[model samples]
Target: MKSVIFSFLLILALPLSMNGNDFKGIKRITANESQNESNSWINFVKLFELSEIPEKSLTQIACDSKYWLWINEKLVVFEGQLKRGPTPNDTYYDEVDIASYLKLGKNKIAILVWYFGKDGFSHKSSGQAGLVFKNDVLHINSDNTWLSRLNKAFEYTSRDYPNYRLSESNVRFDARKESFDWILLEDNLRGFGRAKVLGDAESSPWNKLVKRPIPLWKNSGLKEYKNKINFPFVSKGDTLILTLPYNAQITPYFKIRSDAGKVIDIRTDNYRIGNTLSVRAEYVTSSGLQEYESLGWMNGHQVRYYFPEGVEIMDVKYRETGYDTEFTGSFTCNDAFFNRLWDKALRTLYVTMRDTYMDCPDRERAQWWGDLVNESGEAFYALSPSAASLTQKGMLELINWQRSDGTIYSPVPGMYTSELPGQMLASIGYYGFWNYYMNTGDKETVEKVYNGVKKYLSVWETDEKGILVHREGDWYWGDWGTNIDKQGIFNAFYYLALKGFKNMSELLGYNGEVKKTQEKMDAFKKAFNAQLWKNGEYRSETYTGETDDRTQALAVVAGLADEAKFPEILQKLKTQKFASPYLEKYVLEALFIMGYEEYGLQRMKERYSEMINDPARTTLYELWNIGSGSVNHAWSGGGLTILSQYVCGVYPVEAAWKTIRIRPQMGSLTYAATENTTVNGKFSVEINKSNGKYRIHTLLPQESNAIVMIPVSYKKINLNNHLIWNGKEKRNQWSEYLGIDNGYHTFKIKSGNWNFVAE
Candidate 1:
């Protein structure tokens, strides 16, 4: 048993503002307008009016335009030679600083676009531009206003480079005779105007044109097209018919609702060119709304519909008919219980995880655990008041899938044909299980999973050092292809597993194993510290002299380092500037656990904000960087677990079965809340902290006592039936049950004013 050691550094620098909040105020402009010919150049100049041009400097401009920006006849930003569609390597928008280029009064911004084809074309249609300004912002609304122009830019172009021409092609045609030009003009003094020029002058050449027709095809027709159909009223067992008409091939989208306001069915009729398609209809007798889709013929006239087996008909509406057509139909949809958007997003994540799992045949079983680990955790966090049950069920599924030899395979079949370090999956799964149990206080689940998890840990222990050893191939391909050798993080996780085993064993009256595991833990800690720590910092390896790596940093943060060395470790973290974005997020978590609150909080804010700014601002990522993989990474999401536990100060110590210790450090955040956190049983906890006051609302299955840690210098404190003062007295309480289990208790603290801690 060797101690996993690492150094810590103090980060004192203020958080950097990557991009100001100014971008959030800017209006969204679309590139796909129905006014343009299908697969032809779209004139977008009529969509907006430039007025009251601010005199301030422009900080940044994000637009998907193959053109130039002219403020009062001065070229500010020029993205030359528009390529077709979005290139994989192109940065989505031109984030330019035109602060030195913008003018005060009336200014003119002109754009010239060519229609080569639709988004998929290598080079065809063109006429897309958006302007990001400094002071006054653009407002887009439902009404067809100049600023209200809508285009499905993200659908066709790369989200990174919004202006790249995604429709490029070489059809061996005369460029002068076949190509067309799309142009737009924005005059703060004169409003806006647009025109299109065809290579063939006889092909309806553009002149002085009035405001173009609103591109109702993409955004106008359906208010909530993706949602289950909303119906005003419906009768039971009625066959609802939804028809959408189009001059060419189109798909009719509709939602069905019952008379009782329940969604009954949804149908889509897919028709080819010159064909009228209709989808058949059926009705079921369910209490809630049901959704479905159908494919048939519709010649801009009659289209059939379909319903689920037990759903009754309520109402229906045509969502968009085709990708390239402007057919619109009207109907209502039933109110759905669940949010369709959220459900769809979750489904997308599931599909992505499944697909990624399929790609790695060698790590199927491990991948399964990995997927389950993330899915279950997300489910737990997502569904409020029901997270505990869902978490339990998900954990049991993993437990059931465990192999008899204590190892778990990747989720996919026939993956990881070789004996790799399957323990990584087991380690992560156990962590999730333990976390859920601690949060919900479910003894039964802990008892159920404990043996399997212990067995899994047991198989990995090497007799030579009495330490868990994972082979080389089993290591995760993380930061710079670094090979792990008895890695620090792995060792820390092993310590956690042993701690869990000890707790469960004690609870189950398995005294002998508990003592044995405790002895092993102590020995492991000693060896780990002696071998891994050197020169006031934790070395990356016992054999190598590399002093600072994320793994070593995390090990120290995870409490695997000797307590006596913590102060020195903390100093090292500060010196190393641990707040660098290049560092792994898990290392940040480690710092938080080591009491580097300011440093950790700053890093969290930066990382969280970065994630939010991304086009796919998701709670998870495959790695910190975008587009690293086809699927969002599960491990990155796992970092949230650490965030909730440490930064939010929601500690679920076993000593106090019913109490949750909260020590919030939200800098400058006016309001913060986390909900539906399952503790033990079917219990839940929701925490809200604002203006220096913290509140903990509990939804427990049974009455239990909880110990809570509140900030110092509070006017008053409250617990369910107890009140304790801070300082020496509270320190005594913490020491008494430092590593022991106590009954349920709820404690809360309120501070009168803000305070800062000095390192």
Candidate 2:
């Protein structure tokens, strides 16, 4: 029996090597129900008994749809990512140590597994479906021995726009349609048939279930509710609205005791203005104890619910999502708006952050590559050190999903990534590679996936201009604007990719690859200037003679322009019109690059100021005006990343924080302090301006070198009044230049705290 699970795993699998462990002894199981799988939606209930519990009893399992296990009716991990299945392989298994949840006597185990069993946008199945449960002393694999009955209440349905990417199902739950509590040891299964077996053969790869060599992806669950507002008519009338304090990831639950055969229409938000998940429920039992259960989860700042007219009155209870992690970093100062924005920015990331960095809790819970890049920009320093694991997992997951044509899907592990463009692949190679390597100094990851990523990048390389042109089967999403030529943005990202390979070359001792990549990158930049630079700013469209924010922003930040053109570039860059929070990240980086510290901070405040008050936003928003996209988009929190790395002046110049860099851009900010954690260790910095004296205090990571930069427009500078750094009369692009260009002073110091007062 153990050999049954280990035979094929003993051979080899492409993704299994990366997980660092081997397959556990477990047999894949399924009901022998008829070949028409989707026609009969069924839950396989397996009843297994253990004579005695072992001291180290551990249970792990993986199923196609979703499964809830009851060890004496004690639920595990509350119900997880089983429903939105990610191409079930060896990596998606969930393992839990059930030593404490078990008793010595005859313990019972029952699992209700839901299989969508159909092709859709979310779960594009590999076809073979089953469940495998493994433990040292006992086993309960899905087989014909398991009790199976068709579940009639759930009928999978699709939706339109706002709820489009949602893999939703309409639940017309008839409790009378439900079988008795077969989950309990005492419930009778009068006419249940045994589940037909599935995934049992060794020759077919899809028919096997292997142990998860790596731990399951991290789960940063829901947020703690501020205050729950029940609409005035939750129980009294048909229509109701529950206004949350701010945007949140929530699961809606309804506990009702209505008369039998009553129908109720429930919504997760207001239909006319905001996104809402529609849930339909029809009661079958007359009020003993019944639940409408949870719909396919919803997220919003304010949500509305409708109960419909002519339904009998019943009680209701609503529960919010639970907080999975406590954010550890802090950012605050004299300005209340920045403080509020910083706090909300952290929430924005955490709200959408879970096992994967979901783009939004709404619509697409899919992982967007660049969004993860910007997410780690703040998440690394803001959340606990443990949270870095998610970033690691995210990068690996993308790499693990590389396609045969050397193309990695842009929004990973999704069925619809069939057409995302080559430009969309930029972050996976550049931002993602650099962020992971620098933050954690994990080279094993680089060693394992760098070649696959390079292959992915190879799909876009061309010989004519050393830059990629959109070829067959590519999609372009260059922010939200009509006139901008997305190609310019694509070139900028291409520059970033070449640079990523160059960096990877230096790290891996591939000196030839480094020179080759650098040569191509240089040629690409030269071609960029000749083709796109028009009248100071980079022209957005190749022939339209138009320029927009993203084109210039991405080019400048990617360093496609020489330093001589920066001041000129910034002047034109800031003038171009629109900005979405996602694009604003690159825009912010470009602003700080040209030393517009004051201007950058002002832009951030102006854009997010309204979000700070009126309703006192809990997370930074998807759009500048609010109510546009998911309220907690990952890239929206770029403010905190800007504040921590640029304003407070703490960043890593090399892989890991081995050589720390600090160049504070305190344009109008009088004082600020920041505490952040990295793979190397914890570090912080503080700056205060009193009267005419500017005091700077910094705490560098214990074993790393610190590169500090001080802003001194007109100064005879001194470190503890001894003069460690002096301002030059020459003006560099990196200085604010209050009549002088060399207003900023740079320093390299050893680990430990240092203080300097400049005047």
Residue 348 lDDT (model 2): 80
Please count the clashing residue pairs in each candidate, in the order shown. 107, 9
The candidate that wins on TM-score is 2
Compute the lDDT of residue 665 as modeled in candidate 2: 75
Displacement of residue 665 (Cα, Å) in model 2 is 1.2
List runs of model 1 lying over 4 Å from the truth: 1-223, 226-382, 385-406, 412-430, 441-448, 463-470, 473-486, 540-549, 571-585, 615-619, 654-657, 667-671, 677-702, 712-759
TM-scores for the candidates: 0.46, 0.84
Candidate 2 deviant stretches above 4 angstroms? 1-25, 32-52, 81-91, 118-122, 139-145, 153-164, 201-234, 270-285, 302-325, 462-473, 609-617, 626-628, 700-702, 712-744, 749-756
* lDDT digits (tens) for residues 1-759 of candidate 1: 001000000000111111223333334333334344332222233333344544443233332224344444454533222222111112122233444544445333433232333342122123333322223333321112322222222122211121221232111111222111222233332322222222221111111111101111121233232345456544444544544332112233433333332323322222111121122222222233433322211222234444433443444444332111111111111211112222322332222231111111111102344344444444343433232343343354345445666665443222222222433433333355665655555566667667777777666564355445644434442233243333554566567667767767777789998899889888887766776677886653443524444546656644577557767776765555322222344466666656666676555545544443444332233433443332233344433443444444455455213554545444333233333323332333344555656655443333344344444444444444233333333432322223212222224322211122211
Q: Candidate 2 overall Cα lDDT vs. reference? A: 0.62
lDDT of 2 by residue, 286-346 (tens): 4444665443445666545455453343434444543344476888677888888788888
Model 1, position 192: C-alpha lDDT score: 23
